[model samples]
Each structure stands twice: as structure tokens, then as C-alpha cells.
Target: MRRAPRIRLLLWHASAAIPVLGAAAAFYGPALERAGGAWPAPLDDVYIHFGFARAAALGHPFSWIPGNGYSSGGTSLTYPLALAPGYLLGFRGAWLGLFAALLACAALLDLCRSLRRLLEPRGGPGAASSRWVAWVAPLFVVAVPLLDWSWFSGMEVALLGAVLGRALVAVRRAELAPPARRPAEQLRAGLLAALLVATRPEAIALSAPLAVAVAHAAGSLGAAASLARASLPTALLLGAHAAANRAFTGEWSAAGAVRKLLLSNPYPTPLEKAVEVIKNLAALRVQALESALGGPWLSLVLPLLGAVAALDRRSRRVAVPLLLGAYGALLLVALNATARYQNLRYAAPSLVMLLVAAALGAHALARRGRLAAGVAAALAVAALAAPSAGFARQIDHFARASANIAGQHVEVARRLAARAPRPRRVLLGDAGAIPYLSGIPAIDGLGLGGYRGMPFARASVHGVPAVVELIERLDPAERPDVFALYPSWWGGLADVFGRRVDAVKIEDNVMCAADEKVIYEADWSALAPPGERRAGVIDEVDIADLMDERAHGYAFPSPRAGWVIGAVLPGGGDGAPRFDAGRLIPEGREQSFTVGAAAAFARGPAVLALRTDGGGPIALGVAALRDAGGEARVEVPERPAGRWSEIRVPLRDVAPGDRIRIRSLLGTFRSFHVWLLRP
Candidate 1:
């Protein structure tokens, strides 16, 4: 009998730990295995902390770029500080995430036990009436995938939970302590209150009411002093931090709270927003809860009703639960009113409070005996099963999808780094995984990265992604070396820039150079490839200057045959290779050219040109980068007339090891620059 409660608590804890760890590993393992990627966080925002953590480890300490000084896009100001120690030691972030989960589970269990004890005095239909509240409530919550997923994500989520959990427990115990020790208890609670708000700006709203309630329960004599002590120190720290941020970056909130002011605010300009919230809440809230909790949204009501019923007799104050509920509701309202409504991440944190409430409710029902406990258990399982199963599927699916997308981004970043005049800058809309992987100083096209007050950040208000707009509007001096804006988020590549060359697509991300000459449609000629192969390759002779990739090693292979389009390179000018309005050439073997000196390889056939000499589009042979001064070679089966020539060169002629002595005659035209249409 002595071991029974311990055994039961262990089982409850196990229930929480096992499923969450399994789910996180399932979602995160593949990402960790891949280079330049992290375990896919439930929110891309988590990487903001990861970036800061990396910076802190490197001695730059919170700056994304080392030696560039401190700048952070992280929402949690202190979270990077917490992660610094783990990151400095060079532990894989995923393993650290597991450690955090364990700590969070321990805190959660403790919080539930405290709630069970606190609510025990309340009779009738309250959660503490049941003996199993401590165990069942924790089990229900941990089994839910959304809470676990967010908990293990590389953020300060678990730490915050632990802090809040301990504080709530302290608050409960202080109410029952003897009068002599009440003053000291109140002071200690005040310090915890201070720590809560000081740790996170968002925590202020959530922790404020709970602190007030705790002070009130401490009685009227020292209540004001306790609350004031908590508030003053927290205010001073926040003031100092904000002052420092303003000094450095000219912003009050380094988290970019002002950028999307309307969305972040619970109340927007129009009075109708309040009404809209009330009206639409009924329709959308249930769906949102279902999506986040991955189960019957009704299950949440169990805790809520229990909290209300337990509070009915005033045996114990359910302040923390109510405060958490209010915080979630307010956050939801703010997000719903703005365009920033996301995958319930903002609301999921509130679930921790609900779990406490459920424990109180479960205990009440269980106290009614075997029949009541059995009925409550049946209801709990039914409510939770679907969401659990659904979330599992979501984890698996996200892992698979992110691999394809993140892999492509990584490939592009590597290629750009190696390209001559190697670019040190990139700008993209998907700011997290790509920037982390793309071994370069990357800026958020949305201005969500430390460039908080910029025009792009303003334009992205209401969750509208405006990468192309920002790129187009930015001054020429501010233009990054590489641009990765998905056309779907903005507009088409051609419409935004007068012309874009080196059309590159990595998974969902699309990239192109502003001054690119030619781009190849990968699918125009693929081995039955998808339209996604249309992610173009740089092929054309660039109209502007770029240290071409060909001079490096991005070589395309030979093609079977070639056909003349509206225009071709070397436009019938023997003195120089002038690609005439109409010209054709044969596809050669491996896409390499043997010049007078070292060999140079072009990436692909220049299938499409950004600009045409005439009003219509022109075709140029793929451009080749070299050590400069290579004697050009133009090989066709038979040199044909300039206009309307049917040119067909066999692949056998340009076999490997056949060195074509290239001489650059001022007016000589060359054949298609490359054969294959891929890197």
C-alpha cells in the first residue's frame, strides 16, 4: 500500500514521457540526420532562438552574424541565454530538447499533485473529489501531440512551464501555511512572480492575475507590498532591457512587436473587431482547439467546468487556471483579429493550465467511486484518441515534406557560396531553416529577422507574405547577393524583376538572379520529370556580370539532339559569335568545352533568355565561366546559313577526350554552349 501512490505517479509520468518522446523523435530525427537543418520545430520562430543560441556559443552572443554585433529576431529575449550553456558545449539541440521534456514532465506532475491537494477540501463536483486526478489529468495532456510537440521544440517553452508550475504550487501551499510564516511565504511568492514576468514579456499578462490572487490570499496587510515588490523589480529589468534594445536597434521591443502592431494587439482599431471576435469565435475556436489538441475539443471543458465548480464554494482559489485560460483566450483573439493566425501554437501553451484544471476535475469524479471513475475514463479516452492518432500522422508527414524542401534550400546555399565573387548575403521569405543552413549571412525578405521596423515588415502585416514586394521596393544598395522569393508568395519572377536569370527552385522555394542572362527549364527536357523540374538552371550568357558557376564545377551532361528556337548564339557574325535571330546547333557530349588553356564547363544549355535584342525573346548559347581569355570553339556538323537553318549535329562527334581547339574569331558564332539542362 505504501508503494501504490508512488507506483501510480510513476505510471502517470511514464504515460506522459513515452508518447511525447516517441512523437518528437519521429518528427525530429530526419531533420537532425540532414546537415544544415534542425529537428523541424512546431513553429519556424523557434529557430530564431536556435540562431541566437548558435551566435551566443560563437562568442558573438545573440547576433546572427558573428563580428556584426548583437541583433535578434527571437521572440523570447532570455531564452537564448538559457540555451547558451547547452549550445556552448556543442550538444545536438535535439538531445537537449529531450532533457527539457523530462524536466517539463516532472514539473507538470508536481503541479497536478499540488492542484489535487489544494482542491481536496472542496466537496461536491470538483476535480479533487476523485483520487486519480493527479494521475489521469497528466496522462491526458501528455498523450496529446500538440503540447508535446511544442514542448520539445527548441524554445523556452518547457522552462516557462516549469517556472509557472512551481509558482502555482507555491501559491497553493502558501495559502495553507501558518500565519507566522505567511510574510516570508508571501515574499518568496513575490520573487517568483518577479521572475515570471522578467523571463518573458508575454508572461506578464499570464502571471499578473495569478500573482494578485496569491497576494490577496496572503491577506490585506502585506498584499500590496508583495505585489509591488514583484512588479517593481520586473519593471526595472524590462525597462533596462528595452532601453538597451532601443540604444542598439532603435526599437522598443527587439521581438518586433511593433511591426505587426494590429495583430499583436488584443484590440485593433475598429470597434467591430471585438464583435467579430465574439461572433466568429464560436465557429473557429472549436476547430482551432481540435487542431491544437488533436482530439475532441470538448475534453477541455472538463477542466474548465471543474475549475468553475471548485471555485463555487471558495474552498481554494483557482486563480492560476483562470489566468491561464484568460491568457489563451486573449492571445487567440489577438491572432484571430490579425492575419497572423497560425497552427494553434500560441494557444497550446495554455493547455498546461487546463491540465491542472482537469486533474482537479478528475479527482472529484473519481471520489464518487468506481462507476464515476469508469465513466470519466471512458469519456477521456474517447475525446483524446482521434487527436493523438492525427497528430502522429502530422509528425510523420511534416518530417517527409521538410526533408525535400530543406534539402533543396541547403543545396542552393552551398552552390551560391562556391560561386565566384562568392556572395555572403541571401534574402528569403522562409527565414528559418534556409538561413540556418545557407552558410551565409541571410536576411528575412519579410523583415521578420532583426530588421524589425523596416518597410518589408510593415508590408507583411496581417500574415501576408510580401517577399517580392520588399525586394522590388528595396534600394539597389540594399539588394542582397542572392534572392530566394517564392513566386507563390509574391508574384512571378519576370513580373517583379525586369528579368531574372539563373532561375533556381529548391522544393517550394524559388530563386533567381536579378541580372541573370539565361535560365534553363529543367523539365523542358527531363526523363519524364515533374513540372517541379522547371526550377531553372543558369545557362544563358549573362547580360550583366556574374562570376559564372561553370568556371567552377556545375557541369551539365550531353544531350541527344538540339533544335533551333526563335534565336541562337553568334547571330551570323563570323568576326564574333553573334547569336542571330534564327540559328541552330547540335547537342554535344558531356557539357564541357576544351579551350586553349584549362577546360571550362557550362552548367546547362541556355534554354531561355531574360531579355531579347529585338522586341521578342532571344536565345543565347549557355554562358561559360573561365580563367578568362579562352579561344572559343564553334562546332556544328555543317555550318548552315544564318536564317531558317535546319541544324542537326550527331552526339558521336563531341565524344569524351575529343578536344575541340577553340579559337575566338571576332565574328565567329559558337554552337549551343551546353548540352544537358541540369546542374
Candidate 2:
């Protein structure tokens, strides 16, 4: 093959720039117009980055709320800091988003140039002119709907792609460089490797190929020495991030990973978590191929090209390990249940890595005979055409999603910001826009922002009561004054402890969790101990108050094990909420609890006054109430089920430390409040 004419680097970049920026403009123009000339981001998460950026610019780098301590909620520590410059320049609202768009555009353009460098031929006979690869590669990436969507979404996806793309190019250049200059090029690749990991931790798997190339760079020192020299920057940056998190939150990883990843959730057993991981891994692979790809069958092109590339002698080492590392990245993401969410953003990096490898495979085939070249051309055309066909629809979805976020989250935040005596604290299930736009301190109900991660994450799994227990323990000054939540997201917690103040509803909602998000004024007066006291009452156990239950040594089987908190309000009217928030025992099952008092128990016999829903026969016993006696039992008759009733069991020598066991011997029932009284 004759040598192909070389184009100036500037002109090559312009060629890639025209298409990539044009596509980004195509998406943003309609999206901004749909959001009423406002730059509403495609997802709520974009505002999270903006919020952290503002904090960083204001001299509080990791603080989610100014004056608040550091929070490890954000997944990317560097992206936010990178955006801080925009905030420092007064890029509020839409301008901040525009700043991000420009940065993203530059990243994509750089990525295109890097990709071109990777595909160009290094002198060899019949190497088939790679001039076509330059124009075709950038065009193909631009034609991809998902990549273009992410480019303008104001997220870190574009930056991550560019970093990894440039890192690969640098590695390839170092590997083929003259021995005298190899070390310098290897160092450059290593620096990009550090940036790649800082942008997104999972990219560590994607960066494995770079690590190998760096360690094995020609004319380098020993593998360990070379690897260390290249990796020092990454170690220091990652260590600083971890140390900051440990100092503020007493945890090493970011709060987002802890709360969002499936492995971090509270599972009953390790076996159950293993089961979920396997299911997630299979589902992620299927979704990546069938749903994320422009066309379902286009998925076959990746593995086919990868196989051909792996079989080629010259590229085998890079191809085989790159393919395996990309797979490892995919599996690592499977540990996050949201691996396919938000247009599969979590899985996009791995998919893009595979695409880059496939591109190399295509380049390898083109260097072969006419038949192989023809095959690569056909597959490439088909792959590019499918994504191009879907660009129109993806752009429309992007516009609508942007509009949904603007009309709902942004509008609600504006209202909150306008309120007089501005809310001291706002509790939110969606933590991004509310705190940033409203300038209010936020308690992230999902534990992704200001809330302490592990406790909130574990409480989230156990249901509302567990969360309420944590909330009530907050310092009085830090308690939320207003709650902004999607009604469906918080299971009965809002209805139980809040009075509805307003609701923001939107149309054709495809991004926010629900069509309507309601605001509530926090109300806890109902949870206080009731005013009226029963005759001869010595100590009371308020079952409805989770904290009180904790103090009284409450224990029950799992929510799935027939025990759940239950409550009733007569006629469902606006009267006092009958508090009965503890174990709902099934028929023939027994439950037990301990009763403690602040003062010493009176030296006399006492009566156990139990408040419950009337069922059939009930047996109440004290576990070793008297040291010299066996368990004491009492039987009570059934009453109607609609109203609350009290049953008393006589006790002798029972102390605060003793346990009281209740058995619903006949019919399923609820145990609400218990009191120990002088008889």
C-alpha cells in the first residue's frame, strides 16, 4: 500500500471538533429551549456536582453545606473541584452548566485526537493506509447517541472518557517509542492514569492496560520501580481523598458508594448478597448488549472484533488483557444495583473501553487482505448507522428529561428559597437541587449528601421506624424544619410525622422518581408520651417511640418474620394518632420485651397493664419474675377487634430487669403500649 498523505494535527482536530460539538449543540439547543431558556441538567445528579463545586469555590471543599463538616457523598472528588473555577467566575444557574458543556466538549475533542493516534499505522508492508481510520473513528464516536447525550449532560462521563482515551494513546506511543525517550512517555501515561482513577474509582480496572504498558516500557528500570514512579501521583491523590473522608465521616470510601452499592446494603446473610451479585452480573451483561447498544445485534460486533484482535500476533498482549480488564470493570459495576440506571451511565465507561479495543481489532483486520478489510468496513458501517438512527429520539428524551427536572426540582427549590424565616434544615430524598438552589442545610434522607452514611444506609433498609430513630436522636437545632420528598419514596414516614404543606407536580415525568414531590412541616409532638396516665402506673413503655423501645430493650424477628410496626387513627379522621408502633405477632407466636425504670422498682407486687388490639385468648408471662419460681402466666378473654383494650396480669417480685413474654395464643394481634403499675 502506498503511504497516505499526512494532515496537519490542527486540521485533524477541527474535523473531529465539527461533528462532536455539532451533536452536543443539537442536543443542548432543544433541551435549553424546553427548559424555558434555562440550562436544566439532563439528570438531578448534575446539580450535585454543581453544589459541591460552589462549596469548593467558597473555600469549603468537601462541605455539602457551608459551615457543615466534610461529607464524602460525592463519587468524584476531582470533577467538582475542576468545576469550581466556573463558580468562582460567577457562573450561577445556566452559565455553570454552559461551563461544564465547554469542558466536556474539549474533553471529547481531545479523546478523538487520541483515538486517531491509536489507529494510525506504524511503518510495515501492506499495512493498509489508516488515513480512513482518522476521519471514520471520530465520526463513529460522535454518531453514538449515548456518548453525545453524556457529553452535554453536564456530568463527568465525557471527562472520564477523554482521560482514559488519552491514557491509552500515551501508552501505545510509549510502547513503540525509541528506548531513550520511552521513560518520559511512560510517565506521561502514568499521570493520566492517576487522573482517570480520580475521576471515577471503577476506572481502575479500565486503567489496568495502561499500568501494564507503563511497567513494561522499553529501556525502563525494573517493573516495580517503573510502576511506582508512574503510580505515585495516583496514590497520593487517592490517599488524601480517603484520609479526608476518614477524618470527617470516620469512613474510608465515599458516602455515595457506601449507600448506593448493593454489597454495602444490609443483607440478611453473605449468601443472599452472593445471590444478588450473580443475578446482577447476568442482568447487566444482557442490558449492556440488548438495551444500551443502538441495535441489539450490534452487541455481537464487539466480541467478534475482540476475538480477531486477540488472535493477531502483534496486538495479542494488549488485546487479551484489555478485553479481560474491561470485563472486570463490568463485573465490579455489577456490585452496584444501579449499573444500568440513568441510561447505563455506570456501565458506559466499560462499554466504551470495549469499543476502543474493538476499534483496534478493526484496524488489525484492515491491515490484512481485501476480504478482511471489506468485513471490517461492513461491520463498522452497520454499527455507526444504528446509533445515528437513534440520535433524534435520544435528543428528544434528553430535552424532556431536562424539562422535567427544571419544572419539578428547580421550581420546588425556588419556592423553598423564597419562604420567610427560611427553613433551618430541609430533609430530602433527592438531595441534589434542593440544598444547592435553596441555600438551606439539607439532611439527605437517602444518605448521599449531608447525612452520616452507614447508619442512614442501614436504617433505610430496615424501613421508616429505623430512620425515625436516627432522626429523633439528632440535636434539636439540627432537626429538619421541612421535608421535601417523593411521597412514594418514604414509606409512611411522612404521613406519620409530618403535616403536608405543599406539593409540586409535573407532567410526562421520566427523570424524577415521581410525578409529584410533596413538602411537609416536621411534626413530632404526636410522638411524645401521652398526657393521661393510667391509675397506679409506675413505669410506661411507649412502643410507638422507637427510641423508647430501644431503651426498654425491644427485640423482634425480621419485618418478614411476621413483626412490623402498626398504627391506627379512628375513622381515619384528624384526631390523635393512636400510637401502636411495635411487633404485630401472628396467631400462636410469642414475643418478649424488657421494661426498665429510672428509679428503683418498688418493693411490692405489680400488675402488667398491656394495651393491645383485642383478639382471642392471650397468655402473658414473666420470665423468672421471682428467683424461686418458674415463669408466671395469666390468661385473658377476647374482646372486639376495632377498639384498643387493656389486659392486666398480676405479678410478684418482678423487677425492671426481668423480661415479660406475651403470647397471642389464639388470634393474630398487635402489642402497642405496656405499663407496670403498683397493685
Candidate 3:
């Protein structure tokens, strides 16, 4: 029946859409939901972007909240625009998901368009010949290592690819069109080129080949002028972005110029600096190639094939832009390797050129039949295997680990919020969920202009000095209630806060400590009597004495006479200790040494004491022992002075019946000075 044929067509269309839908689901489903689920940490830029999007939704464009900070240099306005519709539809996750979906759709469409051109016969070639060539052409384009790289992150590469494809089509159409209509075609070509530029600044390099191809195909200067006019919109957009940068940062260029200036040292000659820049760019190109292909071999081989294919008469015109764009990318990579942070996404604008070249090559090779099939199969396997391996490895590590770490930060923020009074300012070094979940303003320690300045100003009011003095005034009572200092900045804080008063262990060896002078009521009352007490009535002495009495011995021990050691073994597979002697030893080398037992100390009254010199400053406290009588370990009551050279204890402090043992916690100490003390 006629109905059967229409039903078949509908089914075919639905089947074609299945891949796009599946890809969208894969990219958006779990990934977008988990995007901002984690708190502040390294590589948490996704969350930062999500937070910015949320802020934008709340009528606070360009304003960053506590946990999330402002975009420092270049902001991605495209992401917000892409997400705005989904956000309005009441599916905030759809903001990121929809963008990813659109990108996938664009990529698929671009591939189909490129394939169609490669399949079109030249010089009256038959349909069968064109089909044979086009089948492999699609495979070659899809199998490129660069395309695989785009899958890791949802980026503008797909959109750029689609635009380039459209431009290439327009260029081809203009060449075959009538002279009177050529001008209109050129204008359309230019407009497409301009759109590509608007989407990505890097597309300017691609535009060069487009302009030349359009002009050559149009066959007249007047037609080229009309085409140039069509490109004005893209020029205006670029000009506006530059102007905005100048207005905000007082620089004509983007913030990247400032970064370049700061990162580059003053050279003796311009030539020398230029040479250095070239070297750096080359290194980045090498890295980009390796990232795309999984190794150097594929990087060299695929691009060579592309070049060869572009040289063919039917493909040479399209190949020109592809080659130029590829070279431009190499130049960009060599000059700014660090900018490859986006990996393939950064190299994506040029991908259309590369794909076009590959498709042409595939078409030319298909004339050789079996050879083309072999090459296509090999390229497909390589592309699929490499990306699959990379994705599997990444998922194995990031899927669970990222979630757990993010959850930990969320819990930490919650605890801090419950303990702190309402409306209290919390000064956190690494801004995480503390600002959002804790309902407190968060500040970044890196000093990039946010609420971070407020806490630093508050701390300075209490006579505390800070690195950046962004604010002028602060109330003493309004000082930072908590100081979340990461280990990296721990040493730096000594100069700012005078001393570290208390410490709490957090994830990744993160230590959240506070200054003794800046006391919190929650901390104070935890040590006070069970009955209610007025915070204002407690004088400095009452607080200080309570702190001193309750303070445990040194949280960690300092090394003096001996080094701390672990996991040492003798050559014969016997367990022993290894000592450090200010020199490097070959792996698996065996050595022995002894430490004197003259300076061990105890905190409470005991009849037995053991002496050893291996525990670093942190080991000064009581540590749990397996053979000891009690489950809890007692710490030294007094704080050590001058880096804790040795532990000293009176003979009577150790109990007679308790088994005493001493061992180094971290350094290399082969032997211990064992001794028992009696009253």
C-alpha cells in the first residue's frame, strides 16, 4: 500500500535521529547533573561555570557569589546564551545538557554535508563510482584523531565545523553559478565566514582561505567587495569584544595579553624573544598532536595522508584552507602550548579543513577499491580504540573519586554553618560549598577581587597583616570566624596571622586552622562548663586559660637527633629500619644505624618511659600503641619550643606495668635508643 512507503520513510527518519538522541543523552545525562555537584577544588572550573550561570539566572550577571569567584580574564558568553533557554524551561541541568546536544547535532550534520560533497561525481562520473568513494570518505572524516578529542568536552568545535562546511558549500556553488548572481553568492559566503569568526576568534585564520577561495571562484574584484561587506557583522562582534576588554581592564586586547606580559621575561632582543616564542609554540603543537593521535606516529601519518589527498585536482581548492588552518593551529600551539588547556576544543575550528582534506583523499583512493577500504578500516579502528581507551581510563578514576571529594567538601561546609552563628563572615582560602551551603560569604586567598578582600581586611583590623590589602576598614568583632588554610598556603599564613592556634584535619591533607586571638563562640563554649555561659562576660584570661588547659600536646612531632622511617627491609627480606644521612642511596640498598635514648619525655604521671628519636614535630603527642595497656594515647601537656630537638621526660611519669615502645613516624631511623625509666 502507499501508506507502507510513507511509514517506511518515517521509520527511516526516526532511525537516523536515534544516534543524535543517544549521543545527547550520553553527553548530558549524568555528566551535567554532576557538573556542579562537587565543591571548590582544583579542576572544579565546571562547577564555577555552573555557579556563574546560576548567578546570571538570578539577575546578577557578572557577579560571583561566595564559593564561586569572578571570571578572571576571558569569559565565555556563549555558554550562558546556549544555556539560557534550558534554564528558563525549569531544567537547570538542561543548560549544559542542551548545549552539548546542540554541539553533537552540529557535528553530525557537518559530517553528512562533507560526505555529500565528496560523493558528488566530477566530469560526468557515474553515481555508482561516487557512492563507492563517498562511503569511505565519511569513515575517514569521522575517524580523525582530532574528532575523537572533541568528545572529551562539549565545546564550540562542532558548531565551527558546521559553519565551515556551509561556507565551503557556498564557495563551490558560487564557482558554478552565473556571473550576474555571483555577487549575491559571494555575499552569502562572506556572511557565513563572519558567523564563524563570531563563534570563535581562532576562526579568523580559517577566514583567510575562505576569502581567497570566494574571490577566485567569483572571477571578479567587484564581486569580492560585495562578499567582504557580508563579513562586516563578524568584524563588528570581534571589535565589540575588544572594546569591552579595553573598557574593563584598560587594555586593548583580552586579559591574555596581560598574562603573556606577566609570564614572559624581558629579553635582550626582539629576535631572541620571537625565537623563544616559536620554541614554546612548537612544544605545544607536539603535545596537541600527541593528545589527538595517542602518539607521534598517528599524528604524522594522518596529516600526511590529508596533505596528499588535498593535492588531487578535485580536492585542491578545499584542501588549501584545511592546510592553512592546520598550519595556523600548529603555529598557535607552538607559541602558546599552555593555551592547549582546552585540548582539541582549542584546535577544533581548523578541523573542518582537515576533514574536507581527508574526505577528498578518501574519494581519490576509492578508485583503487580494496586499498581504500583497508585504509578506512585501519583509520576507523585507530580512532575508536584510542578514544575508547582514554575515556575508559578517565571514567575509572574521576567518576567515583570526584564525587566523594565533592561530597566531603559539602559536608564540611554544612558542619561549619551549623556551628557558626547566623550572618557571621567565614574566611576560607579555597572557596567551595561554604558560601552556598553554609549561607556565608566566601573569599579566595589568591586575591582576584571578591568577598575575599573583606575577610583579609577584617583580619588586618585585629592587627593581622595580609598579602593584598584590598579593603581599608574592618570591625574587630566582624573578623573572620574561621580560617580555611590549605597546606600550600599554610607557611604563607605565618607571616599574615603571626601564628597557627588550632588545627583540624580535612581531605587531601587539607588543614583548617585558626588564629588563637580570633576566637569563635562555638569553639569557646565547647571547652567551657556544661551550664550556659555569656560570651561577652568571658575575659581574655578566661578564654586563654581555657585554651591552654584544653590544648593537646603538639599535633605533630619534630625530628631532631634521628630521622623518621617506614617500610625498610634488609637485603635478605628481613624487616629493618633505614636511616637518612644527608645523601641519596640507590634503590634497595641496605644500611643500619643507632640513635641514643637520652631525651625522651612523658606528659602525665607514669612509672615507665621509653626513649627514641625518630618522630618529627608531630609525634610529640601521645600515639596509640598495640602492646600498651590503654586504648587511648596520651600527648605531652606542654608545647615544645625551638623545633622540638628532643623529647624529655621525668622517670616517674611512666607506669610500672605498662609496656612502652617508641618508633619514628616519618623519617629514616634504622635503630632506636631503647630505655625504661623508673621512679
Candidate 4:
């Protein structure tokens, strides 16, 4: 009898595995066929994990590129670590995606089995419900096309789902256990919580409810003791992750969050930020409900339906946690701007949580009567099986998207890799596929890969000119040899600083940022001072170049507080730097520059010569060091509107260590260059 139950249980799992794996195979087959038998993943982001996994396998864990050092680009720290083993087993290149697919399929299978156990009741009129749930629940969760879509996308969504499923199982086990056994059950829940967070930080919401459910089952003392033990593992893991991120990236959060989150972007006011967040949250909630793959809108209330089972106190323990966790997961993705992008991959965890709660509701309704059972089964099937109605369309989309990546990013990378003398360093905006396939050191223009420093992240948010300023600050040797970027994305930068060496244009572009990408040989000669040094010019500062400003002891509080370097101003064919009211800060601005001793005691008293655009009048204030009370002021009147002109601020007895402060008194102004000249 025991063997028969075991065999029957094995049969149920096998049944779930067949459809799940078969669906994955179906997705992969079309993708491979579309890519001309090449190993291709549906998204460029997939190769990011592959690159990190390759580095980990080669003993450089957390490094985006082997020699690039530690990077926080991998969103799921544990995921690439998990895939690293496959790299050791020779699953390199496109085959690594296959390995990921197989792993995700197994996770889905485990999720199905867990859901079956969670929905199966022990006795009463509900006993018959268990028999049907054994087959229906597993089939339902596995059959959702979006789940299949996410799993085969070669991302961490499935692993997160599996961890959540196991956490639910552990929660249920703790709820039923006697006080003595609760400790061990809680330990399992705690460790799973750690794993859950490691898979995706937002999963902490799901993990928190498990602890609450466990505590609700036992009394205060048992709950406190169990939770104390449970909290240890998660706390330590989080501490270690924080330490590593702080050490390498100077941040407590991953680089992905820094680059992608709307909260991380520059905002003018706190109120505006709050408004945007609320707006995004509302939009995401609607999108999540409407998405066929996210399941029926009915899921929003299914947990309440499941509350009917709470008449049994033990059942109430199960119902409360599932309900909270589902909504918590929803809130997690709803707050993120990128969650709905990339075919809704980030929202998959929330969708899975909703379905799990809905399954509970169906089980509860099935126990009431035959009519209720039939109706409940229909709802369950609609929640799960209805998603498959679009599976064929999803498969077609996967194939075409994979082909798109392979033809564009992969092709460009391979060509570069096969060069006679491989380029020393390549810069890329789309940092995923190219870096992984080419095996070249890359400077990710977007800072998603190995590009170091918060300056890059901050500059990227401000736009091309700010990015150019950051690049100007880099040492010459650190600059890239070639740039691979979409003309549509970085046209100004490329046109100003690079010579086009080659280009690639694709037909019917869908997944790429643009239809055409150009490769350029870096040519920064134009960045040098335009003409010969003028006579009597003792010292000068290229005000637009951030590095030059820094070298001349330029000081301003605005940029740090959200003022941005303006767009590249084409002043009579010159790339002049200026400041504008970017996202938040006001147009009015002020800056201070130190006049060197060489210029202070030149042939005679110095004159501050400023090459500027006559936007408005500016006030110039001069004071010598240690002579604060004695200061001089000069007013500069506006000139022609569209052209560059020179303005002079005459000074007397301006000895060494004197300072010059320029303030825009009326409207915005642009200073191309500032010079300390002898009269």
C-alpha cells in the first residue's frame, strides 16, 4: 500500500514534468530554428547572466568581465552562481541557455508538486476535492504560457517561483507541527527566506509573510523563538551582500537598481517623485490585471474567497500568509518601472503568487458542493489553462526575438572578435550580448556591466553631455579603442568624437534599440584646445570639460544637487559646454574659479577674459585671499543672442590666490571658456 501511494505520487510529478518540459522544448525549438540552428536566447539580458556565470566558473565570482573586477550588474546574485556549475560542465555559449531552460523546467515541476500538496485537504466534504486538485492544480500552474515564457527567457523568475513554493510548503508544515517540531520547520522556512532574497531582493516581501504565518500557528514564546532562529540566516546573507556591494560599487543596492529605478533618477521635488511613483503604480496594477499571462482579474479577490476555509483555524494560518504575500509581490513589481518591460519578466513572481492564492480559493469552493466544485474547477482552469490560449503566439514571438538578437548583437561581436589584431577595448551601449560573445573587455556606456564608479551612473541619468564629461575625466589609457552603438542613441557623441569604421543595419528591427548600429574608431583630437594659445594668457580653464573645471579648482553645489551639464551646444561649429535647468534645478547658477599665482602676478593687473554666449548679464566678483573685506565687482552686459562673444572683468592688485566668482544675474548664460590674461 505504501509503495502504491509512492508510485502514484511519482506518476503525478511525471505528468506535470512532461507538459512543463515539453512546453519549454517547444519554446526553445522555434527559437533555435529561427536563429538558423544557432544557440540564441530571446533577450540580450540573458547573456548578462551567462557572462557573469562564465566569470564565476573561471573563479572570478561577481566580476562582469574577467579582468574588470567585481560588478553589481547581476540582479540575482545567486542565479549566476547557480549557472556557474553548468559552465564547468562545458555548457558554454548558447548551450548555457539550454542549461538554464532545463533548470527552470525542473523548478516549475517542483512548484507544481508543492501547489498540489498545499491545495489537497485531509478530510470532510473537501476530501473529494483533494483527488481532483492533485491533477488540476499541478496542471494549472504548469500550463500558463507566460510562466513558460519567463522560464525559457533564461532568467531567474522560475527559481524565484520555486523558492516561493517551497517557502509556502514550509509555512504549512510549521502551521500543522506541534511546538517541538516547529523549530525545525521554522529553520527550513528561514533558510528558504535567505534563498528567496538571494534570488531576487524584492522576494523579501514573500518571505516575510512565511514568518508571520509560522508565528500565528504557535504562541508568542514559540513564535518569538522560532522567528529569532529564522532571522539569523537572512540577516547574515544580507549583511554579506551589502558589504560586497559597498566595497565594490560604493552602493548598498545593485547597479541595476541604480540605473533602472525611477526613484533613482533625478527629480525636481519630493512631491513630483511621489506623484510619479503613484502614477506608475496605478498603470502597473492595471497592466498586471489585464495581461492574459498574469491570470484572470479575479485573482485580486481570490484570497478573500479562500478566507472561507479559515473556519478551520489551521486553514486560516495558510490563507492569511498566501493572501498577504500575493499582494506584497504585486506591490514589489508595481513600484518598479522596468517590471512591465521585457515581456513582463519582472512581474512573473507576482503572477505566480496570485495563482497560488487562487488555487487555494478554488479548493475552498470545491469543498462546498458538487455545483460549487464544478464552478471552482472552471475558474481554476481559466486562471491557469486559459493562458495557454496564446502559447502559440508567444512561441512565435520568442523565435523572432531570439533571431533578432543573434543577427544583430551576436554578429557584430563575432566580427569584432575575428579582427586581425583584436581591438584593445570596445565601448558598447547594449552591453549584454556583445561583451559575452566577443570575449573583449568592454566599457558599458550604460554602466550595466563592468564600467566602474557612481559618476558613470549619475552621468548616464543626465544624458550624453554628462556622460561625455565623465568620459573626459577618464585617463587616456582607460578610453575605449572602438565604440559600438546605435546612431539613434548616441548620434551627438559619436559624430563629435568618432570616425565611422563600419555599420550594420537590420530589417524589421524589433528587440534592438535601433535598426542600425555603427562602429567607430575613437578620435578625440577635436577635444583639444581649438587654436594656438593667445598672447598674455597665463592660465585658462575649459569650463565645459568637467575635468578641466576640476583642475582649475572650480566649485559649484548645483550639479550634485540635480543641475546637469546642458546639451552639446554647437556654437559656430564648436562643441561648447553650458548649463541648463535640467530636470529639477533652476536655470540661475553660480561658479567659482581660482586664479593661479602665475596669472595673479603677470605683466600687470589681470583681466578675466570669458568666451561666452550672450544669454543675459552676469556679475563678476573678485577678492584676494586673506583680504575678504576688499572686493571688486564688474557687470557684463548681454551681447548678440546667437553668437559667441568675449567679456572682460578688469581687476587691480589681484595677487596670487585671488578668486573669481561668476553669477548669472538675469537669465541662463553659457561660458565656453574662462581665461586669466595679463593686460
Residue range 1-679, candidate 3, lDDT tens digits = 9999689546544543454445444433444355355322222333334444555666655444623333333234454444445445664431343444464575665655545664476654333443455434444444433453353244445556666777777766666668888777777777777766655556667676767766656565464474464455557767887776545433355433333331222212456557766766555556555555556665555565567566765566666777787667555534442454433345554555665665655555444456565674465345434433354433333333333334444455556666625536655543444454565664444322234213222222111122222211233443454554544443323333323433334343211222111212212111112222233211111101111112211111121222212111121112222211111112222211111122244333432232223333322222223224432332433333222122443332342223233333333322211223333
Q: All candidates' lDDT scores?
A: 0.46, 0.72, 0.43, 0.69
User: What is the Å distance of residue 602 in model 3 from its true position?
Assistant: 73
List the candidate 3 regions with Cα displacement exceeding 4 Å. 1-43, 55-72, 93-123, 132-185, 221-227, 260-283, 333-337, 340-356, 367-391, 394-679
Give residue 461's lDDT in candidate 4 (0 to 100). Answer: 56
Question: Which residue runs of candidate 2 sit more than 4 Å off their true CA positions?
Answer: 1-7, 126-128, 177-191, 216-220, 224-247, 251-253, 267-283, 313-318, 369-371, 452-454, 527-679
Quality of model 1 by C-alpha lDDT: 0.46
The global Cα lDDT (0 to 1) of model 3 is 0.43
Q: How well is each residue in 551-659 modelled by candidate 4, as lDDT tens digits?
A: 5676553533434443333343344543211221223556677766544453346777777664556565545444444556657676766555677877664555666
Steric collisions counted per model: 26, 0, 30, 0
Ranking by TM-score: 4, 2, 1, 3
TM-score of each: 0.60, 0.79, 0.55, 0.83
RMSD for all candidates, in order, please. Answer: 18.5, 6.0, 18.9, 5.5
Cα lDDT tens digits, model 2, 49-134, are: 99889989999887666765677877777789989999888788656898899889888887787788877777685366434666
Top TM-score prediction, candidate number? 4
Measured on C-alpha atoms, candidate 2 has an lDDT of 0.72
